[model samples]
Target: MTDLAKTDRPRTPVLDRVTLPSDLKGLSDRELRQLADELRAETISAVSVTGGHLGAGLGVVELTVALHAVFETPRDKIIWDVGHQCYPHKILTGRRDRIRTLRMGGGLAGFTKRAESPYDPFGAGHSSTSISAALGFAVARDLGGDPGDAIAVIGDGAMSAGMAFEAMNNAGHLGKRLFVILNDNEMSIAPPTGALSTYLTRLYTGGPFQELKAAAKGAVSLLPSPMQEGARRAKEMLKGMAVGGTLFEELGFSYIGPVDGHDLDQLLPLLRTVRARADGPVLIHAVTKKGKGYAPAENADDRGHARGRFDVLTGQQAKAKSNAPSYTSVFARALIDEAGRDDRILGITAAMPDGTGLKQFAERFPRRTFDVGIAEQHAVTFAAGLAAGGMKPFCALYSTFLQRGYDQIVHDVAVQGLPVRFAIDRAGLVGQDGPTHAGAYDIAFLSNLPGFVVMAAADEAELVHMVATAAAHDAGPIAFRFPRGEGTGVEMPERGEILPIGRGRMIAEGHSVAILSFGTRLSEAMAARESLSARGISPTIADARFARPLDRDLILKLAAGHDALITLEEGAVGGFGSHVAQLLADEGVFDRGLAFRSMVLPDRFIDHDAPYAMYDDSALNAAHIEAKVLEVLKIGQLDRRA
Candidate 1:
């Protein structure tokens, strides 16, 4: 719509010749710099069309070129920590042709995927995993593997996670020769917050320590004596009067930088020197801006972290107007309303303030909102502590990310019977982000936890009541999951009411067949009911709000009253439907000759696509539900065939 595809394509003479990283080996430093510029242009151009991560790839353009030019990828391993910045890497490693297809169905993945390319030795969607993976590669090389060098390019925000430190400690203990390039962009998806962020800020800005440089040179005794003296002084001057890298040195790594990541002249030499001279582990701190070039991205909020198709010239995103409010907004407003009434209510999110919709809540109640930096485990336990201390804590997280804190859920909250309320966003097949971000397992995982109250909203209105229900429930851990997109245009309640804990309300009454729905799939069930009605089969429809507490009375009544019963949910197999089946089994409803079926997400991981398309592929859409009902009833289709 904005002519982004035309009049904005950058001329890339140097980049045109490069089909692979091997081609970069022959180029001069000046040519490589030219190529980086072209690559950056190409990255921007490609992302403008496809709309994936813009700022991260832009930030690491020079670093990506430098890493590939210096190291023989597919032989030497370079693992990107979060993979959001790997678009430039993908471009260099012969994925340029399909770069525009990122996150599309059957297209190149948004993250570094091992299955997509040989150069991607490891796959990653989550952050803070590169260090450990690189260490594994390093150890593998030591144990007679072919990998030449193991390099991990990780962002500063990723370093805040406990896993990175754990990996660093192990690599230090093992005394392996490893290279860790700390890409200090001063940001993640949200502006990073933690002591580590402050430490990194101080590391580059604080005065230089000549002793720190000398210690680094001393640690790598393999360097030639003449070069060692020159390198030590060079490092000292480059460090800029800062007593930095002491923390890394204590962990058994020779710290080398605080260098300009965007400058090819500085990056190429620093990297080449490290590749040639380092005897043991080396940590290079490379400072960079998150959105390095392209005025639009650099100037925008979020630093153009993720975007839709946009006007390349103006940086205006092409966002379609939503017909209804997003489920996230509904949850946020509901929580904010509840928090206003209760002073003890506190909100917590792992690293996502905007993604979890806590940004607005924080604006209203800044003191009560806690963003624990990409540490889900800490967030869960922290919320548990808040609940333990007579506070009402809502631990809101994307359903997939909450998997990281599963142990905390079981040990700290569920087992201890803490009153931490979990508001799970992105609770179904999220479009474009693929299976890595899907919220498929949360229902199954949380429903099984002892004394846990699990609910799923049928619509935005139901979400409000569920939030209130969660706020009032101080008996144990309660969680409610909602999908990623807009609600079904239902009228929103002015205020939420606290409903009975385990009761499901009937929507439509019929005799022959019944459809019991949970979560957002209630819409599909209603549609299926209409189709059945057209065929003179007016099937009953009910919304099962709670999943953990088997709505025994409602379920049994549906089972007894109907000739056939179908359970539906937007979750994996062992969730609402499975629980319903289990309850029916225990109550001997199956012995009464009631034909039953459960419709849920299939066993396989659904790939990235539009949400409706994904559901259709999973055979959980309205048409699929109608077909299943017809087949189960042995009606029109069976009669016709017979």
Candidate 2:
């Protein structure tokens, strides 16, 4: 696992000829092993440049090569769960040319995309979806489609999710000929959690029971042909004693070995065997190591799950130093401070303790923190139960991932009026992850629920106050959202203060126009105010902290004082802006001569790019703000330019 340099990449003469999976069919097992090594090297090199997902792809390199070599892809659909491990698949399936452009604007996607290639039968960025998608392809194939032998390569971490089990149950009932490769690397972004992970661990690491079962199997054949029925019963008993894969068998799936995923010799033969002679549903437990080949990734924490651009020689990531603290860190510190005083406080994350800054909270209060694996739906309900039992549960989740638990949020928390604090991270235009991970619809969705208090932090300092506010308020469900990047370099507060609910602060008072913003777009609104002032138009700027409560007095005051009012937020159309418009329309404010406008994220999914560029594309930037103001003021575009 020596570090690679730009000029000293591994030689892949065989891989150079493999432009498609069809080409892989011609190679021998030895050549395929060599190609796997080359593919692993290529994947590392590509990810080093692009700085996307690394460890999962490295772990699955041999599997990807073997799958391509054995299966007739494009016709034989291979669906990658979460798609993080699809880098090697992308490289082999004729996307190697654009590999370095991973997650870039107008370039290769970091995950498997059906539209990007013929080999990608289904697209996925989120986890635990491949099994269901592959089952659909299987059903379609049975009903007179050409989608051959549907295969789903899902991680063990993904298998912990409820959706995977739902799909497996249905697939088992249908008894379809499907292949589910359980890539049991013992990690998924974070160290795997929950009962399924424990079961898989027992399967791979033989315990006392497994040893007894093995001994029993060896002795079972000693019985005479007249006692063959007894031997068959003994074998079934041995299988029952075997610690792993018994649950899968009970669900009507034929369980196969806990094989070595990295070993090409093991992978090639087993996969070929399954492809040739498998009926009904089959689960192949292939144990692998995340960040398998590369030393830097293997040695590091998280096994190099996700990384920034780094020096291949030293494994030194080129992280840009930020003077300001990240929004995540700010929220983490605030929550830690509050939790120290309030012993009733408890924290929960679905699977993203690190991503949502709950790792810091967990370090401080280990007993109070819970990582519920990748089950968001369970996390929400679990938090609701904690709240019902009189614990102040802060259910922290990414805005995108929160969509998975909406039903639970509605039924358990919102409907029952549980006091669950939702500390939502990654709440806006996350730069490279794109629309698949965007936090666009949370505000609209959450604000619509009765008795739900939705707040967005305007800056890191404001986030501290909101954290305190959410902690202090125990009446009902409260949520506060913050964006992905660093804060605005605002001065630190000694401690958070619990501000009044449903109130906003005015930054400046001006005539003719008032710009009311709901989230971190306050900075853009202020910048637009400066630009407007230079053109002899001084617009008032206000920050609406609460989206749900509507800040009736502040909004009404602004509407009455200003000739034109513009509502801005970093959410979708039906969010804060839409709520304000509804209030204005209901109050008959818009019926008068008040020219109103709501500037929100455009009515489409924006692609991966720099945050500012994505904002510009969505028409929510400073310039766009200025243009909206001018348009509301009845100023022509040409005149404004002049």
lDDT of each: 0.88, 0.87
Give the CA lDDT, 0 to 100, for residue 21 in model 1: 96
What CA RMSD would you report for each candidate? Answer: 3.3, 4.0
Clashing pairs in 2: none
* Superposition TM-score, candidate 2 onto the true structure: 0.95
Steric overlap count per candidate: 4, 0
Cα shift from native, residue 476, model 2 (Å)? 0.3
lDDT of 1 by residue, 1-642 (tens): 122346567788899899999999999999999898888888888888888899998999999999999999889999999899999999889999999899888899899888899999998888899999999999999999865899999999999999999999998889899999999999999999999999989866753322224344464344333334545665655566434677787889888666778888767866776688777888988889987878888887789899999878887889879789999999999999999999999999988999889999999999999999999999999999999999999999999999999999999999999999999999989988888888999999999988999999999999999999999999899999999989999999999999899999999988788999999988988888887777788889999999989799999999999889999998999999999999999999899899999998999988888788899999988888888889888864523332
lDDT of 2 by residue, 1-642 (tens): 323665556567888999988998889988898888888888888887889899999999988998888898888999999988999999898988888899988988887877799988898989999899989989989999875999999999999999999999999999999999999999998888988998898777872111112224464233223333433443565554754567887787877656678878767766776677677888877889999988899998799999898777777898988899999999999999999999999999988989989999999999999999999999999999999999999999999999999999999999999999999999989988888899999999999999999999999999999999999999999999999999999998999999899899999998888999998999998898888887788899999999989899999999999999999998999999889989999999988889999998889988888889999999898888888888888875524454
At residue 583, what lDDT does model 1 achieve? 92
TM-score of 1: 0.95
lDDT score, candidate 1: 0.88
TM-score of each: 0.95, 0.95
lDDT of model 2 at residue 76?
Answer: 92
Candidate 2 global lDDT: 0.87
